[model samples]
Target: MAINKLPIKKLVEFRRLSKGRQQTFANRLKVTKEANSGGGDYWVRSISTISNAFRVNDNALIKAKLEEVSNLYNAEQRSQTKKMYKRNIDILTKYQNFDFSEWWPSTSLNFLPKPQSILEMHGLPIQIRPQQIFSYGAENNQSVGGIWLITWLQGYKDEDLGIYSEALFRYLSSYYSEDYIINPAACMVVDISKMKVIGYDKVIDGEIPSLLDASIAKIKAHLN
Candidate 1:
């Protein structure tokens, strides 16, 4: 359903399977609002990976070929084949119209606005701000990475509000894939308003075993 995030090292090798076409798509992917013609290895790899992983058939290749056949000068000679191919391609093309390459990393800066909105919607403090975020180590490094935030909510008074932690995790997990956030390298929760360290956690293996509860607990403990 989604293109999951791979480690920088793994993503590099994966993209190489397309002989650097992944980079080309990556370049076009960020700014482009929609899928277009003229794809490369990245596009092929994404379709292949999703098809195999999800046990679904990807007919984009077939559809493109069928369209080419339909446009041939002697298409009337192979009218039966053309009709059948057109029927199938048209049905499959709807699902295939979307590009999977866009999922490899997020393409929208809208993710930045969600935390504050969700927090406000839940009546939590509005002072939350991102301290550090993760990246895929590219030229722009636009992928959503780990998040560290400084918040004004007094941990001692609001430590029981699991909603705060849940809101952050939910927003990130929803926009980005669960694979993108399986583990964050470092997450620091600080209280600069009081000039203190609320809590800090780093995962060598990048695993968030307990999700938000783990981070919330660590930071709350510091407040105690």
Candidate 2:
């Protein structure tokens, strides 16, 4: 049987937990997978709302989209799903006026790129999936593309953000070619709740890769 793929965020958290908690977390990962046969759409509408605002340069769309999602959630039959949707909407409502200027200076962004292929971690079962990819600058700018990995998780320290940024950059380097015009400096993690933009500006200097590999190895052992 194929091994279940663990999200990068879980892998990051796994390394920080106590040994006992690690096992509990690994078990929870398994239980979560078995409980939900398909991927969750908890943040789909919210993310689409934000992405659409950037794509169309209309901040008003954020409020409008949230209203649409809120109505749908109210009518949802599944309690768990409805709660997830409501939570996402509540978070978005707080930052519906989110300042895109913090991430990009351009007034308008180019068309949203097609989703990138899933990033496999060097023969490991772990995968890294970026939430959004966009390009901005002069209409014909060559170095306009950027990768933004959105995380709603709160209380992440700067150290954690650095690790995420480095991991994302490594994955982007492996998967995308020059044709994509991906700006290494533009690669970042968007901490929505914190309203902060973080990038791998200060390279952790050869430590992050080893740290990630070790974490993945431990996670793999737990999976077995």
Candidate 3:
């Protein structure tokens, strides 16, 4: 049997959905064996720019990338692609002035490749993929790191943010614990739309694991 795969953001959204919606999502997942690649390059361009900016400590790259997209938006003739480019332009413009130093003062960011691991839930192999990982300096001279999952969707409640943070924390702690100490300060879900960061320290729900397990069980049942 082929194992099911879900990005961390989709899994978090699934957890917050109503029972009816969960089943609907599960049915869609079951039938859609291939990855959905229909979305435009807005997220792809933006994420790459953000990653490159951190890797080289150059915020200018952000504006540079925005200009590239803006130029394309201006000349595009297709309405749909033009709309996508326009949206990307707006998002990149907002992010161009963002100060990474404010959130990660005095720390260096070294970007690692995206991480993925298979999680067995209710006798099912569910692959979880988080977007980015970076190692940063800590106060005690300890080597610690964090995983960041970006979300373009808006209106995520605090509870949703907490669940997303906890899920990313568990993914790193379970898979990469031997390599580096996963710091709560490092793990985060970056809300690009609102220019907000939700860190692992904000995960207040002690029952997150149980909640996730229940959500997984429901997903498994619906898969059948």
Candidate 4:
């Protein structure tokens, strides 16, 4: 591997390339159009608002900084959710503070990939930028009775669900699960009937479902 420094030309070239792949910017454009909120580059300001800026190319620099941002975001969300979960627990157990840390994200909600190519969804505290992960795997970690919760993160603005759903289902049939016997080259089974688990594509064309859905489903499957 070699480290290539970006010259003026390279920078310009890279900027064009990146701007084309500017997912966040495209999203901002959509939201502004949809909400009609007198848009004034809120997302731009948010990115610029980072305290200590680091170079884009350095992996260590990017990871550390992004993780720091994510930690703060994920922790806050978990705490808020914990408060609610605590209330629920109290309602059930008569105000006993049962530990809600069970799933209340020690880290933050971010997509982390392991050595085995099994991407694990973690407690996402901060915003996960593009460089943080490549592709998504299953949703969150609580796999009960050999079933997994898979979520497709939004790809583009409008049909983000379709992008992820299509990609993830393909992954299931081609690599991980191999639901049915499709052509080796065109190697994904399009239908769910042949799937091993009682899998789904319900929210494939929408926002991601919480990992708890998988957990609850596991419990329900056991009860049945």
Candidate 5:
């Protein structure tokens, strides 16, 4: 099949196939089906169907194939063909990381929002600023990308207790920035009832931060 000729419907058909069949098609298309830890196939399939419904037919796999195609054939001819589908291909590629699960908030959570709400339920307030265009070192000196509905916690004014601040800082820093970034210094958790602040230095200001060492364990400990 011509690399540039695969339509959106074809991808929809491929996406609907069983994992084994999808793997076979992936081999044929010369596209790497990157594996996610859980439900990767479902995500890929769902997104492909959504894109197809919108009549998007830009083939990212084809562009990579074109690079290979160029090595063997006339470069000028292939470049002209690429221009025809470049827009669709560019858009589809940009949405490759789309997560439907995260895009829609849980109705069950009463629209409380994820991560932040999750933290709140556990008696921690995640302070996220109003949505801004640029999050990382952009318009302002703020370092957070703030892509998630909730990004950084609020500044420590009323919550200026030392232990909480230190614990929050450690937790924020340990997180990956692939999706969003959080400020380590500015921490404003809304709920502090569960957190038993024993003393500074021992828990918060010591050489090792308890939040960092047992972030999950601490949460579970609190529940018990």
Candidate 6:
């Protein structure tokens, strides 16, 4: 699970607790990722405030310790994250001219063969309708949760097909956890790191997404 604000602290605090108190801590973490990870402050606060009403066995103290840890770590993470996000926003915005905007989709004049499209350094995703989303999980169809990278077919008809992901990719670093990314083609399933591009095979005739994925993989390999 993606380590969120309070879990690490809560876990650490639990270690300080006596065995009985530790059991309570264990129960909370076991409840759900959302328990400590979800960002709604009201929800987070309720866990402790409500527990005070029922601190039957060192519940209140353990909880208070956990909250302290959570708040401290979250604050630190927020500060560090803010700096990184600002850096990201600065870089992404500085390169806005290179975005997948149709204004200039060809390769740089300095380069030969006039490149078709440029890859945005930031990773971005398309906002296809629920109906338009093409889901392909593992062989068992068990590819649950987590961000999935994807590629798309571009042609004369789709100039910006794999360029910039969306209009809001730049500003997102300010308020969200995602690290912005842009691949030359929309043909990858990557995590937050933005370093790996998943490969794909095509369906002979012409499945747009499939073809796009395969082409993206080929080009990406050469670039690396």
Judging by TM-score against the true structure, name the best candidate: 3
For residues 57-169, write the lDDT of model 6, one tens digit per residue: 23344345445545554566567654543433332232223222121112211111111121232221112210011112233331111112222111111212212122112
Candidate 1, residue 210: lDDT: 31
lDDT of 6: 0.27
Candidate 6 TM-score, true structure as reference? 0.20
- Judging by lDDT, tell me the better candidate of 1 and 2: 2
Q: TM per model?
A: 0.25, 0.70, 0.80, 0.20, 0.21, 0.20
The global Cα lDDT (0 to 1) of model 1 is 0.33
Sequence-dependent TM-score of model 3: 0.80
Candidate 2 residue pairs in clash (backbone atoms < 3 Å): none
TM-score of 2: 0.70
Error of 2 at 142 (Å): 2.7
lDDT of 4 by residue, 146-203 (tens): 1121111111221222222333333334343422221121111111111111222433
Pairs with steric clashes in candidate 5: 125-190, 127-153
Query: lDDT tens digits, residues 181-216, model 1?
Result: 422322323222232222222222332223343433
Note the clash tally of each candidate.
Answer: 3, 0, 0, 10, 2, 12
Q: Write the per-residue lDDT of candidate 2 for residues 80-194, one digit (tens) a residue.
A: 8888778778757866786655566355655455444345564654555555566666555544445443544445665666666767777656655454555656667765556
Residue 32, candidate 4: C-alpha displacement in angstroms: 29
List, residue by residue over 8-96, the lDDT tens digit for candidate 5.
Answer: 12323443467577556545543422211222232233233333322222344434443443343344356645443342334334434
Ranking by TM-score: 3, 2, 1, 5, 6, 4
- lDDT digits (tens) for residues 58-96 of candidate 3: 779989998898888889999988987776676667767
Off by over 4 Å in 2: 1-4, 24-40, 70-86, 105-116, 135-141, 152-155, 180-182, 202-211, 221-224
Candidate 4's C-alpha runs over 4 A off are 1-158, 176-179, 182-224
Clashing pairs in 1: 134-145, 134-146, 183-206
Residue 21 in candidate 4 has what lDDT?
A: 51
Worst 10 residues of 5 by lDDT: 145-154
